[model samples]
Target: MSLTAAADPMLPEPFGILRKRRELSDTFTLELEPLGGHRKFAFRPGQFNMLYVFGVGEIPISISGDPDDDGPLVHTIRAVGTVSDALRTMEPGGAVGVRGPFGSAWPVESAEGRDVVLVTGGVGLAPMRPVIYHVLTNRQRYGKVVILYGARTPEDVLFRKQLEQWRSRFDLFVDVSVDRATGRWRGRVGVVTKLIERAGFDPHDAVAFVCGPEVMMRFSVQALNERGVADERIYLSMERNMKCAVGFCGHCQFGGQFVCKDGPVFRFDAIRDIFSVWEV
Candidate 1:
């Protein structure tokens, strides 16, 4: 209906920046809406979009907005490189080109009737936010939702207010920890994996989704295994050097898989040995 063929999926669509809010000093969220009223870009919880900043460049960024929020598409970006820094400077009404909502997603639908454990570190929470949104939207579909987040420091936390609100909900559980604390900060101080022991969930009935630095994800798998969760039940969002958000480019190759096409989200058991190799 949109007059685009799946084969030629590289065309970037026009979008208008509707709003922006700084979540942390270096990271912010951009709210964008389709230009010319194109059919809303629909996607599952863990998908990503290739965002192009006019003349600067493009990069693969996860869609952080709620899947049910029909108002605008949201992306949380940190000012790390040239393109992202350029994007961070954009104001309301800015124009951008978006080319995706690609890659494999977290097994949200399959987690129905079972407990879901989501763990993220640093700005990695952006990709995991949609899963939290999905479960909260369909509260009765899943058994329990456990969220564990860790940041570099107290001031490094992203989505602070939203995290508080989720914690306030009686239906879900949220545990946030900081790697280090500054003045007056007294929350849990350690890596996110340490928070797993305190999280309430049934290993036998639970599915895990982890995203963060490679080290964090690697250790998270060990922690989940220690907690008795099966390998196939643990999913991870892998981050690699990705020049192209689609499979055409080989920049995101990890072992025999291409992160852009095969996954950004993968079952841990499926790729455990591949990623575990020291040379890999």
Candidate 2:
């Protein structure tokens, strides 16, 4: 569905750019404040926004800040291409366009009172970060909160400080892994699935939200199913070449679904049969 013009005003206000150029490993965080105000933008834990850099183009990015905080909006952007590279060059007080609070969000309410496992790889943490924050802030509402994250290497792990804090709070459990470890690394030295195997959560009472590369999500769902989580209970975020965040461009089309509007987040059962086909 296209975002309505009426909805435009409610979109997260374009506040002045906060920290326009801070590097987090190879990626960067472009902090922004609402225009003329310091009031926080209202966004659900797993929603995303389309950020437009003047003359550089736009891309769909997950909102990574706490849903409870009404402060400036923060986005964790990886430097992968031209648009992202340009975003990295933006200085504080520069102007950038934004639209949304878009797409589906993790079912935080439905996961209440149940164990929630978040499996993420690489920048996949961006989308899952809010869910993690929600569960931590309202710890009493959920059962066990487990986070399993894997990166290419030690340098690729995102939100190191936040992950450290989450490690200390609530009934939090975190296992970080890397495909290959450097000399300084002291964590698991394999795929994230290996860590999941070690955590040994009871799948019967748990729900999982997984986001990462398609291959990683596929393997993660397989691992969860092997551990007894039902296909219907496992959720995944599917990535595609999304152009129009409103789902008009058809670039992110997968079979009959639009990854931008219909998903980005989807239940396994809804797309299980289609996933193996590779074309979608």
Candidate that scores best on TM-score: 1
Determine which window of 10 residues in candidate 1 has minimal summed lDDT.
1-10
Global lDDT of model 2: 0.82
What TM-score would every model get versus the actual structure? 0.96, 0.93
Runs of candidate 2 with Cα error greater than 4 angstroms are 1-14, 20-23
lDDT of 1 by residue, 122-179 (tens): 9999999999988898989998899999999999998999999999999989999999
Q: Which residue pairs overlap in candidate 2's backbone?
A: 15-33, 15-34, 15-35, 40-70
Candidate 2 structure quality by residue, lDDT tens digits, 34-124: 6677776888867788888877788888888788876678888888888888888788888788877778888899989898999999998
TM-score of 1: 0.96
Report RMSD for candidate 2. Answer: 2.9
